[model samples]
Target chain A: MNKSLNIDAQTVSVEANKTVEANNTVQAEKRLPGDLAMWFFILAELTVFAVLFIGFAVSEQLNVEMFVQGKAKLHQISGLINTLTLITSSFFVALALTQMHQGNGKQAAKLLVVAKLVACIYISVKIWEYLSLFEQGIDIETNTFFTLYFMITFFHLMHILLGMVILFFVAIKAAKNEYNASNISGFESGASYWHMVDLLWIILFPLIYVI
Target chain B: MQSTNANKKNTLSWLWLLILTVISTYIGSFLELFNTQKSLFIIIVLFIVFLKGQQIIDIFMELKKAPKLWRRLLFAYVILLPVIIGLIYLL
Candidate 1:
């Protein structure tokens, strides 16, 4: 009877400790249930991309020759390079999650910073590519293909910018040690969104430029 | 203990996703099979995407371990929302 009473006391202490720890965690991390929100947002954003894609498909049907011609005019190498950058960034963010899981918040923050840098490189090169095409006499009004090209790629760049912003915030939180494995949802969601951004580029690179 | 479990889950899911990303990118590039057969390529790519995406949503987002209603709501968002949007686009 005494031993059972002792065991009950131990269990009570453990439960109390758990509750205290949970409370401390909530205070320290303040991570809103960010994953569901991010996923739903991604789903909505993908829909927008799909609509634009459908627009492109319909337009392509109307003007296949123009698409072929525009594909010829744009620099495929730049598109490929941009795709590589985004892919590398996606991998970096994935590694960031691993770093956080390992309790290396500073390292995870650094990875996110590096990811953001890669995103900046992607955006810069994309803008330069667009401007160069314009200086070379390409315009959105030039043809149906150019219209879809600028529209879709511009929307994509905006998403990249938005993603970089989210990464920046998550990086700051990680550096503050508020994004360890217990509350890594923000980091994970940011990485997922970045992956989606990268995935879109992967599809767009070949579709818009190659075939 | 909970944190450790979360860590293991994150690492496993991240690895799965990286492999998926690499494979899909290669598939998109190499398969000019889509050139001659547009709808077929779309179907295959979309299927692969849905698989990868559902995994990410389920694992990384913790939907698989969530309550039944939470999972149902997420499934509704994933499945129904896209269909609604696509129909709007079609119109």
Candidate 2:
């Protein structure tokens, strides 16, 4: 009888350990940095950009001379400035997240405002570039190169605007101390989207302007 | 203390990214000025683009701390897109 009791006790102990281990696994599974939904959106955005890039490549291959000429007309200085501005803005946003995580909400908000201001510079420069192109009679209907150029860039610009809107709301919440280290999913989601915008530009700049 | 270390690392990454941007711009200008071996220049510039994308994914996006699968997928996106484009250009 004592042997049977000992066997039952061992079984119960093993079951309890198994439950504890399962609970630990559940806790560990929550370690992803941002909202799972945001990752899905990011994946979709990246896929679209990839397709557009491939399309651009195919078009360029078919019309290499025209593509070269169109690329030559682009303002390298303006492209470089915009690249720098976007990258700096990305840095600011990343820093803002760091500040928020450190419990410095106001500082985070200020950094985001700075990032927005830099984004404004990028937008203004882009507008000047578009006006220059328009003055030179280069529009979406100009050629396949310009068509792809304007379409891709303008689509990306819309994403930038959307990212700004997201950052604006994130900044407000951050200023109100809404995010903590453990509750930064919203902030991270916004940052992730903004970084996506930056990533697209990083690819677009060299592809369109330089190469 | 850990947060401060992270902040420092982020700052350094930002500075490195900026430097890479400047270097790529200089390379573009060099190619424009010399007009030599256009394919080679394209490859170099696109390589820079790939590096910048990776840095952003790893550092700015905080995928360094993310799951291994997420990191691999993102890295693949950054690397593969440029590689395919480079191949298309070369062909």
Candidate 3:
């Protein structure tokens, strides 16, 4: 059985290496078309987010009064600002992808830099918002809604950080002219991930602070 | 696959997203759409984001141009599983 398992592991590694090699060839061939694998990865990510969304929904339904009562104390203005920031950042990333497609690698990298800066600004504002809320004595222990609110938004924030990191890497790669119209999967994938992060914040900002 | 010129058209779409976010925030402050008024804002916000996200997926992600089966599978996996889980939890 152990020998069979070792064979299976070796086979899996071989398959993985073959996939990498094939994908690299596709990249080299400038056949940077979209693929099912990326979508499958995205679908998996969304499923995890959906679970948290469900948690928020169930908690709100279970303790409607407490949730609403807690929501009233939220800082809506800060939330709105953060939402705008994320949306604007997403716009930059999208624009960056377009620039990459136009063969303006330098400009594309600049746009990505802009996107990352905006993301950093958004994070700073969010940290401020979180701290101010804490100062107002609103913490996860406040109630179920606030607890879920903090958890979900903070969770999404981590994703934004990750997106920022990826964008930075893509920006550096673009600087080296590694991505162009013919080889843009990295840029496209990074933009897609950033937009997803922004879209999640779009949902979270209002759900936690505005409503 | 959009060029810079095509991106100009998309800027309007981004503006629309911004406007929607603001409008939803304003609406949430006043309206009660959910079962209770408390989470009405959150529900509305989620709806708006979901709508916008679908648009981005279809357009920016170019999912509409993808193979029909691939699109269907993608949507089913992302949308169906969580909904099923949520409903089961509710039940």
Among all candidates shown, the one with the greatest DockQ? 2
Candidate 1 residues A1-211, lDDT tens each?
9999999999999999999999887655443334778868876876687667667766766776777678778886677668667766776776677678788899989988988888788888998998898899998898778888998999899899988888889899899999665677777788778777865665466457544
Per-residue lDDT of model 1, residues B1-91, tens digit only: 6556665765676566556555555565544555666444444544444555565456554456555665565455445433443343233
- TM-score winner: 2
lDDT (tens digit, per residue) of candidate 3 on A25-61: 7556443234446556666777687678766767777
Q: Root-mean-square deviation of each candidate, in angstroms?
A: 6.9, 3.7, 11.1
Question: Candidate 3: TM-score?
Answer: 0.77
* lDDT assessment of candidate 1: 0.69
Per-model tally of clashing residue pairs: 0, 0, 0
Q: What's the true lDDT of residue A44 in model 3?
A: 72
> Which stretches of model 1 miss by more than 4 angstroms?
A1-34, B1-91
DockQ of every predicted complex: 0.17, 0.60, 0.29
| Tens digit per residue, CA lDDT, model 2, B1-91 | 8678878988888888889988888888777566768788888988999889888998899988777888889899889999999999888
- How far residue B82's Cα lies from its native spot in candidate 1, in Å, is 14
